[model samples]
Target chain A: GAGVSQSPSNKVTEKGKDVELRCDPISGHTALYWYRQSLGQGLEFLIYFQGNSAPDKSGLPSDRFSAERTGGSVSTLTIQRTQQEDSAVYLCASSLGQGTKNIQYFGAGTRLSVL
Target chain B: DQQVKQNSPSLSVQEGRISILNCDYTNSMFDYFLWYKKYPAEGPTFLISISSIKDKNEDGRFTVFLNKSAKHLSLHIVPSQPGDSAVYFCAARPASYDKVIFGPGTSLSVIP
Candidate 1:
């Protein structure tokens, strides 16, 4: 991919329904990250996957939020029993590596609306 | 508590003038700072960055300055243009962590 690519740019679902967001990082990127922006709030870190290392899930807001990266290339973020508060823009980013020189490239984001 | 803060919600600047965006952080462990510019409907793009070891870094018309003592960092755009108008976010990275904390963002409008 030319850059980080996210799918289903916008999603609208019932409050209790489950939703999944997909991210296809740039080819050969070794690091992937997930974040979200709620209304006027800043970007909040969710999860990170680096190579085959165990993901850093400290930033996940709750048990309902989970993510998985397969083969260190494609990633998926799933929200279970979504609430109204979950309505926001979900963003995905990828970088060459997690070193100090890491510069992330982001996707346009998927706007999720929980009715 | 917010680790990073961009107090001003918005800023307006005239074309050919300088646009200054400020950010403050409370965490002392942050070792790297970056600025990202975002336009409506698009993801943010990396603008400039400065390391804690140095007080300043510049690229073309964009410059970033860091003050370790004051826990503040600012981005400056010289001769601002209308095309530069967008929401700018300030982000910081801790030396031992891969996560980056971001500010609320400040929207800048450059008038022609």
Candidate 2:
């Protein structure tokens, strides 16, 4: 693809329901990241993948949140028992690698609204 | 504690003037800083960046300044245009980490 792509531009889910967001990073991008921005808040890191393995999952808010990347390509973020507070924009980004070239390119993001 | 902080929630600037956005970080280990501009219904796009080794970096109308001793950095846009109106985010990457921590963001409105 020409750029990072995300699925389900907007989602409206009832509280306690589960939702899954997907990201297709730019081809050959070695690094992928997940982040969320709540109302009046900054982009909070959720997780990152270096290839197929995630070196950092410390940012995941709770066990209800889980993410995985396969074949060092597409990635999926799953949220279980979504709460009202979970309403926010979920963003995905990809990078060439670490160091000076690590400037990430982002997707438009999926807006999730928990009703 | 937030490793990155943008104190201003919003700013207004007249077109053709300069718009400045400030940011501070609590971590001394941050070695790289970046500025991103985001518009409504769009993803943030990288603007300018300064490495710890450099005190300043500029690209055309956008310039980023870093004060390592104070753990502060700022972005300046000269001759601001209405198209420049957007939310600006400051982000930092620790020397030992690949993840970049971001500030709350400052919304800049460049009025024509």
Candidate 3:
């Protein structure tokens, strides 16, 4: 792809329902990241995957929030039993590698609204 | 505690003037810092960055300054434009941390 891509540009789910957001990182990129932004809030790191290293989940807000990067290419963020506060925009990004430490390019993001 | 902090929630600057956004970090282990700008319905895009060793870095109309001793950094935009109106976030990466920590953000309104 020309740039990082995300699925379900917008989602509206009822409280307690489960929702999944997907991300397709740039080709050959070795690093991927997931973040969330509430209305008028800053981006919050959720998780990251670097090559084969164990996915970093240190930033996940709660047990209901989880993600997986299958085969080092695409990722899925799953939220179980979504709450009203879960309504926010989920953003995905990728980089060539930390060795370069360049800026991470971002996707437009998926707006999730928990009603 | 938030390692990175942007105290200002919003700022208004006249177009063609300079706009300064400030950021502070509590952790001393951070090795790099960056600024990202985001518009409505869009993802944040990288603006400028400064390494811990350097005091300043400039790219065209944008410049980033780092004060390691104070654990603070700032982004300055000269000749601000209306197109530059957006939310700005400060981010920090620790030497040992692979992920970057972001500040709450400061919304800048460049008025004409």
Candidate 4:
């Protein structure tokens, strides 16, 4: 793909139900990131993965939020027992390398609504 | 805590005028700053960026200015056009950090 791509552009689910979001980064990119954006709020870092090393999950808001990058290309973010607060746009980005200078390309994002 | 802050929620500028958006950060460790432009229903696109070693960087009509001492940065759009009307976000990352912290966006309305 030319850029990062995310699945299920929009999702509506009931509270307490589980939801999963997927991201496919650009080919050969070494770093991938997940972020959450609420209405009128800035983007919040959720998780990061670099190559085959263990992902940086420190930014995950709670234990319910988990993400895994398989084969260093595609990633899945799963939220268990979705809450109303979890209703936000989940964004995925990828960069050539892991550093501050690397330019990150972002996907259109998946808007998830928890009712 | 909000390490990066975009105080202005919105700004309006007449067409052909200059649009200046400001961002401030409390973390001195940030060595790279970038500005992104986003439209409704679309992901953010990189506009311009400035490294801590330099004070200013320009590309086409967009320019980013960084003040390391004040921990402040600003994006300037010269001869703003209606097409430039969108939400602008500022992001900062330290030299060693891979994740960038974004500031609450500022909505710029370029009035014709």
Candidate 4 TM-score, C-alpha based? 0.97
How close is every model to the real structure, measured as TM-score? 0.96, 0.97, 0.97, 0.97
Off by over 4 Å in 1: none
**Residue B26 displacement in candidate 4 (angstroms):** 1.1
- The Cα error of candidate 4 at residue A114, in Å, is 0.8
Residue B38 CA displacement from its true place in model 3, Å: 0.2
Candidate 1: how many backbone clashes?
Answer: 0
Write model 4 residue lDDT over A3-104, tens digit each, in one string.
899999999999999999999999989999999999988888899898887888978999999999998899999999999999999999999876437788
Between candidates 3 and 4, name the one with more favorable DockQ. 4
Best by DockQ: 2
lDDT of 3 by residue, B1-112 (tens): 8889999999999999999999999998899898999998888899888889899999999999999999999999998999999999999997765688899999999999
Angstrom error of the Cα, residue A106, model 1: value is 0.2
Sort every candidate by DockQ, greatest first.
2, 4, 3, 1
Local accuracy of candidate 2 as per-residue lDDT tens digits, A42-82: 89999989865545888999999999898899999999999
TM-score of the A chain in model 3: 0.97
**Cα deviation of B66, candidate 3, in Å:** 0.6
Listed in order, the DockQ scores are 0.78, 0.83, 0.78, 0.79
Question: Ten consecutive residues with minimal summed lDDT in candidate 2 chain B?
Answer: B93-102
